[model samples]
Target: MRVRPMLLKAGGVFVLLVLASCTLSGCWDRIEVNDLATITAVGIDQYSDNLIELSLQIYTPPQGSSISMQGGGSKGSSSQNQSTVISATGINFADAVSKVQEKVPRLLFWGQNEVFVFSHSAAKQDIAGHMDYILRVPQIRGSALVFVSRTKAKDVLALTPQLRSSSADVLEEVSNLKIGLAMSAGNFNIMLSSSKGTAIMPSIEIMPAPEGQPQKRYPAITGCAVFKDSKLAGYIDDNITRGVMWFRNEIDMATATIVTEDQGGIISARLNRGRTRLKPRISNGIWEMTVGIDTREILVQNTSNTDVAELKGTRIVEEGLKQEIEKRMNRTLQIVQKKFEADVFGFAEAFHRKYPKIWNKEKGNWEEIFPHVQVKYDIKTVIVNPGKRTVPTNRMEGEKG
Candidate 1:
């Protein structure tokens, strides 16, 4: 009996020891929230003497009573005091980033970065060289939104807007709306590695804030920056950018206005849904592409006397919309092919998909042949809804016919 009691006590002590050891083990790589300085945006610019300038928009934690119980304060107020911009210059991107890190008090964190902007000048140089560090850094996300600024990229990061907390917030919001082609770092990398090595990224420009606004400037998606051979080739305006978007089948939402001679006014329609099909054909040693667009739209505004509710009038309006779309497509195609001579539309890929053997033979001289590649447009538009009033409110009541 004595031996049995002693054995039970020894077993209990061993169990207690094991439990204590397990409880004592804690997180080994724990990092305190206060020790990190989160970066919301990054900007790259070209400096003199072949140097690179790196700018970071670091999020600043609220102090004292500035922070609210619900977390961040009002959107406008929070962003006004929420972030600070710091810059450093070096011979390369990584070097500049390292130098900037030295000045920051806390550990610089990029996991939450929302926007990355490159200046027009910086884009003209070797973008691939500067982009290598961004791709190699495991801490940075591959889906971070990217842009090219018409002015200094740092200026874009510094802009304060009335609607959003920060410029980064504005850029991200606009990109989500699909106002322009949204390109992420990961997708851009794929484009760079593709056979054509052509890419298009949204371009932003600073504009004056809305009247009576406190902020001096705001950022807007103005156009697109075209890249060839992984370097900035040129820029296309907003209209041309929309055309490119149509060719790439990326048009999610847009508005088009057409003037009707018979109606004696303009008719505006909002694109509800759209799709594009590219057909590549080789005939008689000539390569040609046909772009087919099928779209459904809603008649939003009608200044003309045409009764869009009637089948005959609706057909006329539909025909007018188709002609307008075709005109825009042809204008865009002409500029991109004759002027830029760049294949941002992925025509090469279309050809490769249908005629791989021919593509391989012409791949070397795609640049020379792309300009000559004939393009055709087939657009079909249908108006799904006419607004509450078929005719404009401004129209005279006597002109009901």
Candidate 2:
């Protein structure tokens, strides 16, 4: 009974301290929504004079319309000023973003931000350096998506998307679709932190607007940004990008078009799944890696053959596509290994995993040895459907019966 009373008295003192702190207001890190500005999207481009072109997309309360009545009132196509876009040129990201606040009526904020883009020049010069602001900021969420732009980041964000309210939101949704690599701050950081291999971020390009269309245009995901030790070595086309995805086993819905053997036509195969197995062997001091890829595919569209109108013909198409896919994948792997001399596919990681002791000795000579690494690709494909109609969807007008 004496011990119980002493414990209760101690707990009472802790409660009093907690209440006192709450009454004294928040801690030193306190920041309110209205007092601080929100930044929706940020872009960085390299300027010639040791400067940077930084662009910011800030969310603003609807002008001439209340928040509750947004997109619901009887007005036709509501007002245009939902958010603000600003760009500044300075020596760094912080300097540029700070300049933007001078002109904008509303305070700049980044709480609802979604995307961060770096121009090709910025990425090539130094991507990690320019992204320092985003990495350090406590308010800026680490989940924001990242991209490399062909043009200035500001020009890309100025586009008026017909569907989404924010261009940043448009890209956020696209990244989840997995058409390309998942590129966010967290993902980029992880890849940078990886030991053996480097990370690849998707490249964004702006399409020319048609005559009478808007001056600015929405950015499109074009290809992959190849990075070697936090710096961009180069970029690859879509075909090479797809090939890289094959090695990583990230291909879920890729269409492969193959030329028919007997007839001069094209057969497009839709890949359902791609599974890859990499095995490394040391033969007489020469490292050999076998890259076996098995894939399941279906016939989506055929533009070449006509005489073969049976379901059995699908099997023949499958085999042809399998060979074509395999050949292309082999070519890509060979080029990257021998020509680019960069291991973008984690081949080094696989080698290090199995032979840790041997890898340690070989690590010093990896760059010289990587170009000579032998890679073998094996691809298998399967066709599932031939549309709802089993027969040919199109028929010749005057056929000789």
**Highest TM-score scorer:** 1
Output the TM-score of candidate 2.
0.83
Clashing pairs in 1: none
Residue 203 alpha-carbon offset, candidate 2, angstroms? 0.8
- Candidate 2 stretches greater than 4 Å from native: 1-32, 67-81, 99-108, 195-197, 303-312, 395-401
Q: TM-score for every candidate vs. truth?
A: 0.92, 0.83
Clashes of each: 0, 8
Per-candidate RMSD vs. true structure? Answer: 2.9, 5.2
Which whole-number lDDT from 0 to 100 does residue 283 have in model 2? Answer: 79
| Tens digit per residue, CA lDDT, model 1, 1-401 | 69999999999999999999986777776567789889999999998758989999998876654456466555554445578999999899999989999999888898999789999989888688766888899998889989999999998988877677788999999999997889898888787778455888899999977888656588889989988888899999999999999999999989999999877999999999999999999998898999999999999998887888888889999999999999888899888888888888889889999999988988898888899999987788999889787667886778765
TM-score of 1: 0.92
Off by over 4 Å in 1: 1-27, 66-79, 212-214, 394-400
